[model samples]
Target: MWQFLKTWYHRLASPKWFYHTSGRWLPYLAAVTILLLVSGAIWGLGFAPEDARQGNSYRIIYIHVPVSVLALVGYYLMAVAGAIALIWKIKLADMVMVSAAPLGAVLTFLALLTGSIWGKPTWGTYWEWDARITSMLVLLFLYLGVLALSRAFTSRDTAYKACAILSLVGTVNIPIIYKSVDWWYTLHQPATIKLTGGSTIHPAMFKPLLVMIIGFYCFYALVLILNTRAEILRREQRSAWVRELI
Candidate 1:
């Protein structure tokens, strides 16, 4: 099992292998992403029961929660890729780290946008310095910081090292973001979906939420693969294989 894992790790670390394999995955991934997103949207927004308290406005959770969850998850992915690149000296890992930064930033912005839209109805205001929201704002900056650092240097190695360091250092904020609501007195609601004690949401609502979460994950994966493949092509443009393919 260890040998199997090691062999696959080496295979995946190869940019050419990932580029070819992920190309095969793209069509099926795009199809599944579209199907899941459309079905989940119709189920959550159109068919699910309205919130007794927040009413129809709460339906935004179908979009908000999934993006919010994935924004945090994306940061983890970026940081891990950075770590791998720094330690293993894998060019593919650097490509993945770079690809994830902008995507995570976009998702974080969407989470904040939808949260604000949801807030006006529930919190009587669109913007607040609530712990969760503020931490998420900080997260956006962290992602932006990584993006900025990644491009600041003319040398790719320098940029990768700088971005890797920033990503690793910035990870301290992730835990703060996760525990903010629990640790503070804030208007932001506690997580509705819990892994340990079971979700607090009604089954009808939970089902669609679950579907949306999975759909968002698929979407994230699809985009990451597409972005990484593009990065591989750009970086490998001078290689014999890339030259031949082009």
Candidate 2:
């Protein structure tokens, strides 16, 4: 079993293998992303009960929470890829790290945007320098910083090392973002989903939230696969395999 798992890891570590395999997965992932997103949107927006206080405005959580969660998760992916590239000197890992940065930034932006939209009605303001939101904004800048650092260098190797170090260093803020509401007085509420206990949301609402989260994950995977594939093609354009395919 260990041998088989090791072999599988080696295969996945190859960019050519990953590119070809991901082509086969693209269709299936796209279908699942569409199905789950459409179903979750309908269920969360139309069927879920309105909040007693926030009312219809609470429906934004379906979009806001998922994007926000994935934004944080996406940063971790970039950091991990950067770490792998640094440790192994894997070109493929560097590509993955670079590909993930823009997406992470975009997700962070959406989270902040949706959160702002949700906030206007709930907090009587469009923007606030609250702890959670401030940390999240910092998260966006971190992603952008990785991206800018990558391009700033003319040498690809130098860029990879710099981005990897920056990504690893920036991870300090993630815990800060997670603990911000608990540590500080803020309008942003603590997480409804808990690690030690069941979620605080009602069953009716929780089910759709769960579905939306799953949908967002599927969507993120699909986008990442596509992004990686594009990067592979661009970087390997002169290679025989890419040339043959082209």
Candidate 3:
């Protein structure tokens, strides 16, 4: 079992192996991503019943909630990849970290944008300096900082190390973002979904949300894999395997 695990990790850490392996899976992933996203979007936005309170405006939850969840989860993935690159000096991990930055930034931006839109009706304002919203804004800047620092250094190793440390340091904000609504009185509502206790949401509404969340997760993985593949090809352009594939 240990040997099998080690072999799997070794293959995963290998750029050439990942490049070839990902190619075979990309088509299937793309198909699944498209199908789920389309179905979930249509179901959630068009078919799901309106909320008792928020009415049609609440429909934005279909996109807002899913992207907000993805944004936080993506930040964690970015931080973990950065930590792996720094701790193990893994080139593949570094590539994953770099590729994750911009994608995470976009997701964060979407989260903020959609949240602001959702807030207009619910909170009677489009913008608020509440703890949750402010911390989320900081999260966006953290992602952008990683992107900026990566390009600031001429030395690749220096850039990777810098981004790694920045990502790790920025992780402090994640918990702050998660707990901001609880830590202080804020316009943002407390979480409807809970891990331990049963969810506050009705199952009828939650089912389409579940589908959207799953579809969003698949979409995130699809983007990450494609981005990492592009980064790998560019970084490994001079390698024999990359040359042969080209």
TM-score of each: 0.98, 0.97, 0.97
lDDT of 2 by residue, 164-195 (tens): 99999999999999889899977998888887
Q: Which ten residues in a row have the lowest lDDT in candidate 1?
A: 191-200
Q: What are the lDDT figures for the candidates, one per model?
A: 0.95, 0.92, 0.90
Strongest candidate by lDDT? 1
Candidate 1 per-residue C-alpha lDDT over 1-246 given as tens digits, one digit per residue, 9 for 90 to 100: 999999999999999999989888899999999999999999998999999999999999999999999999999999999999999999999999999999999999999999999999898999999999999999999999999998899999899999999999989999999889899967999888887897789999989988999999999999999999899999999999888886
Candidate 1: misplaced stretches above 4 Å? 1-4
Q: How much does candidate 1 score in TM-score?
A: 0.98
| Candidate 3 wrongly placed segments (more than 4 Å) | none
Candidate 2, residue 55: the lDDT equals 92
lDDT of 3 by residue, 24-143 (tens): 999998898788888888887888888898888877887888888888999889999999999999999999999999999999999999999899888999999999999999999999
Candidate 1 local distance difference test against the native: 0.95
Off by over 4 Å in 2: 1-3
Q: Candidate 2, 86: how far from true, in Å?
A: 0.4
